[model samples]
Target: MTDVESSPLGSERERIAAYPLAEAIPEDRLNAELAALERMDEKPLPLRIPGYFRLGGPGFMGAAATLGAGTLTAAMLSGAQFGYKTLWVSLVAMGSGIFMMLAMARFTAKGQTPVIQLQQREHGWFMAKVLTAFLGLVCVATVFNFGQVALGTELVESISAGLGVDWPREWNWPIYGLITSWVALSYGRGGRGVYYVECFMKLCLLAMLLCFAACLIVVGIDWGAALKGLFVPWLPRGAQGIDLFIASSAAAIGVMDWVFFNYAGLSKGWGPRHERLARADVYIGFALPFLLISFMVICVFAGTLHSAGDVPTTAIGLSKALVPLLGETGAKYAFLFGFLMVPLTTTVAMSIVCAIGLHEIFGWRPDVRSWRWKTCILLPQIALLGAWLPSPVLIIIVIAAMLSLTNNIVGWSFFLLLNDKKVMGENRSKSWGWNVGILVQVTMLNSVALMWVLNRMGLWG
Candidate 1:
């Protein structure tokens, strides 16, 4: 097997010609992107960065979907408890996850096939159906929405409180639900709609980064210690430390993230010409934003709440904690607003995932304008019920257990597809380095999942 960088493809035109664009992508649009890539490739390395960076979208969407309640909570908990010791976990997890995404990007671009179709054809109907049903519909549509909406409601309440409003928390869900549903339903409208959704996601990402960065600056970071923690891998002794490490690591990537990213690219008419752009998208658009945001979150908590012995796990708790500890309402508001973007952005991305899942399950092409597509995208609205009803803790626990066990199995399936000559053709990964990266991701995810199982069973923890 030859290295990807040194593959014997001979020329850029030949490489792209070998793997033509799939019909899902508009040929005219892909041709334009290919022409752009050719122009960029002729320039110096420094000149190409801007072109690559400008073309990224799907990666940002993946980052948005994965950056919701789970990531924020894990980063908050890690900083509050370990005080920068577990900071490396987020980096490692996201880095590893980025490798998997890069693989998916390569496969999707060169093969120009939707992941669900490839799975059904290469793996089998049973695995394909089960993955879309349980992994996509159940976990993403139901369980994930419940968590994101609940968090979105809380964030809205906190933002309202910070602004000196007397808005009732009880009414927050409907408002948040309506806003998110409108934003989510806007996707797949047309090229412009997809562009708008991507722009909105980019804005949210920038807002989050700025808000958190401002908070960290106001709180005053211990750069020496934080840098050490960022570079050095360390986990505290005992079960709690291990659990935090695993949570932060595992939360960066998931089945939903994978599905959303691949379809998001396809929706943009990406083909083999977009391969490098896809990698740039993941590394810059996804990995960089995720790492920076999680890092800032951990730093903010580490500075203020680490030794307080009363670290709050929820965003509400942390937002409330910020006011007194920092003695500045602006700082508190900044943190609240920044963190609020998490669930808001995640809800939109997850809605897309569920909608895509619905289309894939029925072997139908995605049509954002269709009643079925619009209906599926609104599935997250059901999560508004979470605002009134108590969070089903036992049910969440059961779902978490199930996802932990099955998530890695899905990773293995992707690995097989990536390696399958029949599916990938000339695009089949030949690099030992790439395979090793995937192996690490699959193995680490499996280990973390098993650890979760043991924790649930009262065996390991």
Candidate 2:
């Protein structure tokens, strides 16, 4: 296990001082090292799924972080209400997401600097701080963290009931929050091993994947119909299609997704040689598993709720919908446990991601081993006491609108950075791949956001 700090570019603290990571090492110096590696390993990276999974980290971390309860709820609802109609959005999201990740990977692979640092260097500090860093880490992720903890608390209550524990309802969320805060701590500053978060994410993703698969099998899906739904894109009349489109596109790639993966690459000590690993992380780790799990989840609900002619509006409703197939107690605990896993993984992973960004923004050490990062991870626990309290609809809407606006700005800004020769240097692929990616991200994100605004004004879907 090579130390990430053991770079030729001085010590780890020195790298932190030269924030945005790339600035720490001279371009020519890093370039020479990459050239040497390329010369030593002549052949292209082969498609080795198993080996890649073992090596990949950021993508899996992204998968775990991105596909939180929101994504699951959306997929289940989509299937429950419209059967396979919105399945095509998943395909589009995945396609758009892969290219978006690869575009960022190009930045990490070449710049060796995190995107935040690049934004600061190329544009200015305000752009980096207020727009990208603050909005992403604090405004966006932090706000969402409250809802996840609240959901985690709810799941804990359900799990307790299933276990026949007579715990007080009022204490459930606080207790669950405290327990999960500890879980997040284990993977924080004092954790063992470098790849723990990635490994943990993969484990959670695998578990969730298995849970969904088992649920699907128990319900018995219509494979022929599912396949067609997958290939054929469908849009419901009115605001539903636009709303799903926005959610799907946002799910495909968001501020946290972009920031997390780029930072994850840095944390993994990825260099030019590890570019293949980065791609593998995005395509194999994040995209493949994310889509598979989502498809399975959708299929499970579609098989049952579609025939039942009922829609599940809440997570519990979605979970209980499986009762007919898995029997009362079996289905109750199955989806309950499955949904429980979603927020736990996101909580831990997002905490680390938040720590990463906060450190960069506040000029703290980038190392997760630092207490600063650990404390940052735990700060969200404060929201647990107030977790069950109702968040204002207008407040939620305002935060979401801000997030969408910031995300669109970040997507376009980074896409421009990806093309900037000064930033990416000769490392830029400048290929059609990233070109198409930025287009997909921009179109979907902006159009959906616009529709949401219009729908709010009762103007359009």
Candidate 3:
């Protein structure tokens, strides 16, 4: 990796730093898109709505990446331990994140500069490096990979055993690495490959939602309580409560979520004309799917395992807990298949984020064919050892809490950049409501982190 302060930019890397990622798009296609945007202004509302919907890709990829093990463990534990009490955490956390997500969209579309470069120019070199290394390398590429690998390997192993094939559990990581690396490395090959990758993410998001919703239906829930839990705010007491709250909220939106959504937009070459389309993508592709999955997962466990004496901590154990409730074979497989999608889809999306982030951090022009890109994308494969690791629940919660605490730094940096007049010019946000939303997000993040600390120290709960 090139040192940001010490290294001088070569011509090719300098060009990459100055322009929008659209510069990498084929000239004819880029021209065609610009022309289409021009004609889109003349089209009526009904016609443009469909076009906006079709333009969604980045949001779903973000959804896929964050919807992995951290989310699953948080939701599962929340439902089982607290019933519907922590439901509002998911809503507020994700809602608060929207402010930052929209801020990123506007900045990327209007500025057309990569976020890392923008950070360096506006915030100084050290702050930029901290955000890049922590958010990009540590959060996504390291800590987050632990849970995804552990849960993913367990689900695959369990599924195979259920089918009467007894593969050795020790080799699970190597097999998983081969399969996921092939799929992730296939990205950026061409237009069709990118489209297929987008479709695959969409399918994974849809399937995960459907499977969890089915399980929720089987166990059945208290609609009135669920609604109250979701809309009403009630904070649970003690260290465990604080930890769950932090985990659920942070998992919804954290360092990785911001990096993935921002870079994915750049990768898709979105510009000023795609601004509205980007907002629609956040609500439709990312927010809607994420909220539904989290809600249903919590509701399912609340109904089935809330009072079940002992709740399972492992993925396989959780699926098996649903067996009596769902009926033999039908219950475990349905839940396992849906649960399987969580890690599988997440690993693919996170690999892409890692690739983009490393390139930006090292000041290299991103190329799908580059050896560095290939190596970075496959870095999470080392996490397959998570198969034999301890409880994913603990691993995921620790990762989320760590990110939530550090999120203060990254969130503030983005907030500053978004409101900078020199950087955004007239495109800078003027909305007071958006500013308040971001302030609330930062406050909530720090408060939860603080609460966890106090509770751990036995000073407060």
Best model number under TM-score: 1
Write the residue-wise lDDT of candidate 3 on 1-461 in tens digits.
Answer: 42222223332234234433434556566457657766776898777766655668878888888788868888888888778877998888889888888887786566667777788888876666666554544455655676777777877778788889876557667777776788888777665456567788888888888888777767788999999999999877656666778767756776667767767776676666667777878887788888889899889888888878878875557766765677653655778889988988888887777777667667777777789889988876767767776645455455545555567877788888888988877788899999999878878876776665555456764
lDDT tens per residue, model 2, 22-102: 333355554554454445346555635666777777888888887886788888788887887778888887786677788
TM-scores vs. true structure, each candidate: 0.91, 0.87, 0.87
The TM-score ranking, best first, is: 1, 3, 2
Residue 406's lDDT within candidate 3 is 65
Ranking by lDDT: 1, 3, 2
**Model 2, runs deviating above 4 Å:** 1-47, 187-193, 328-332, 367-371, 453-459
Model 2, total clashes? 1
Clashing pairs in 2: 22-113
Off by over 4 Å in 3: 1-24, 27-50, 329-331, 391-405, 450-461
- Which is the winner by lDDT between candidate 1 and candidate 2? 1
Count of clashing pairs, candidate 1: 0
